[model samples]
Target: MVTTPRITPDLSTNVGALRLAFPTLMASGCYGSGEEYAPFVDLARIGGVVLKSVTRFPRLGNDAPRLVPVASGLLNAIGLQNPGIDAYLERDVAKFAERPCAVVGSVAGFSVDDYGYVTERLAARDEIDAIELNISCPNVAHEGETFACDAALAERATRAARQATTKPLIVKLSPNVTDITEIARAVEAAGGDALAVVNTVRGMAIDVERRAPMLGNVTGGLSGAAMRPIALLAVWEVAAAVRLPIVGQGGIETARDALEFLLAGASAVSIGTANFTDPRAPVAICDGLSTYLNEHGYAALRDLVGAANPTFLGTR
Candidate 1:
């Protein structure tokens, strides 16, 4: 008797207009420009890279002790460090043209107009496949995460960035808000193409010996395995509240963690703090996801998306 061959499961998924070959993206800030991890992993095998957030002007970032390793996670107050939009456009964007995977530019700003200016400048580049409006960065001072916390502010910022560029606009929301779903709805109404749920949870650490806060900024954004549960719930809620695709993040470190987000309703999972522990985690996740799909008799990654959520309202 002849046996039939089993076909490999498809890992492809769509984030707005960007069709990712894989449903795993190297989260912004942690992965840099994808150049840092080029030596350790094959870029083409993963989905894409959300480049570090660029602002309208240069920032010195937080002082020393910006990172503190806490129980099951990390506390970071990097302050959205970048060379600013003008310098970034002049020296950085050209390098992304050769990246094997899609390049999504991240823009962070203090005000609505700032989001528009930086987003327009970055998305104008042919090298950038999409734009991630980082309205939820907790590390920065002067209400950086304010846009994501307030529904009206989120709408204004998304609208401003939407008017700036025709590229796919992904609004990154904050988990520190009172109601993340409300903000998600506002963003969708403001023309956002997708949503990156749960940036980082606001937290802090103290050193008794030094009699001071562990992080220079006093408060920091917490990420890693610790924030996984919070991020997952945010993704589930946002997925039910809006029809836009969701890129779930926070403290994902392994295939199981990524799988949890997908089941919760994220179309894709962004790897962040996990890279610090293991650079090969992204590739491993892709392999593990394929195995899980095949073992469960699923045909593609999209099949697993929102599998556990009854009220999921995404496009898939």
Candidate 2:
């Protein structure tokens, strides 16, 4: 009897200086530092784990009705609620270090100094594999405008964080900007090691009966399937504009959805809102991606990166 050989494609990839075992990461704010879903899935099997956003000080977040379900997506105004970086380092960092996967720390701030302070501290921690700067949060220092929407401000923030940390810096871009590539170029020029395109798009919903906004914050970040197309376009545009790797995410719920981002030039993909429904989604997608590569005759996962680009195919 002859047995068939099992084919395993290389799923490893790099996002800036950090190397990942796979290309599917658990998006920030989805896994909550990989504690909540530890029992449901094998966190080690996934590519990386991006923890929830933390600040220098603890945040109470928005009022009631922070998360609202929308058509094919979710609207959330969590306001970067976290227990502060000091608390996270003292309590959670040790647990995170025990995990086999790469651990990424997500930091949000109200000022440039705030970004630098948090990043400098996290960079000193050997457990943190990388730092993701969440500049999409409303900048209280800039009249409530998100730093990511302003190229100059974004560059300054990225530069401050870059100077504060030797660890790989991944800036999370906002899709609410007029032109995403402008922000992408600014980050790259400011010394960002990579980009995560993007954070959720700004959107809102109204309660017809009450005639009021469903979210207490009036507007919330739109995530899930509703934002995939926007994410794909942003990744495609940024890929053309900069030479940095990208972690493309929006509404990725399955392996095929992840494949779209890779074909558009993403070095990796992140699973976010989908985790709300399925705790095992990221791991499942990883398995499916390996299956896709083997069945499609692709030698490795990196071979699919930017495969759909005309220039890459010599058709442009």
Considering every candidate listed, which one attains the maximal lDDT? 1
The 10-residue segment with the lowest total lDDT in model 1: 136-145
> Candidate 2: misplaced stretches above 4 Å?
1-5, 311-316
- Model 2, position 307, has a per-residue lDDT of 89
Residue range 1-316, candidate 1, lDDT tens digits: 9854566999999998989999988898999999989999999999999999999999999998999999999999999999999999999899999988989999999888899999999999999999999997432444445888889888998999999999999999999988899999999999999999879899999999999999999999999999999999999999899999999998888788899999999999899999999999999999999888877888898988999999999867
Taking all chains together, each candidate's TM-score versus the true structure is 0.96, 0.96
- Residue-by-residue lDDT tens digits, candidate 2, 1-316: 9864668889998887889988988999978888788889887789889989989998989987999999999999988888898887888788876887999999899988889999998778888999999998767878987899999899999999999988999999999988998999899899999999999988999999999999999999999999999999998888888888999999999999999999888899989999999988888888889889887888688888888865332110
Candidate 1 RMSD to the real structure: 2.0
lDDT against the true structure, per candidate, is 0.91, 0.89
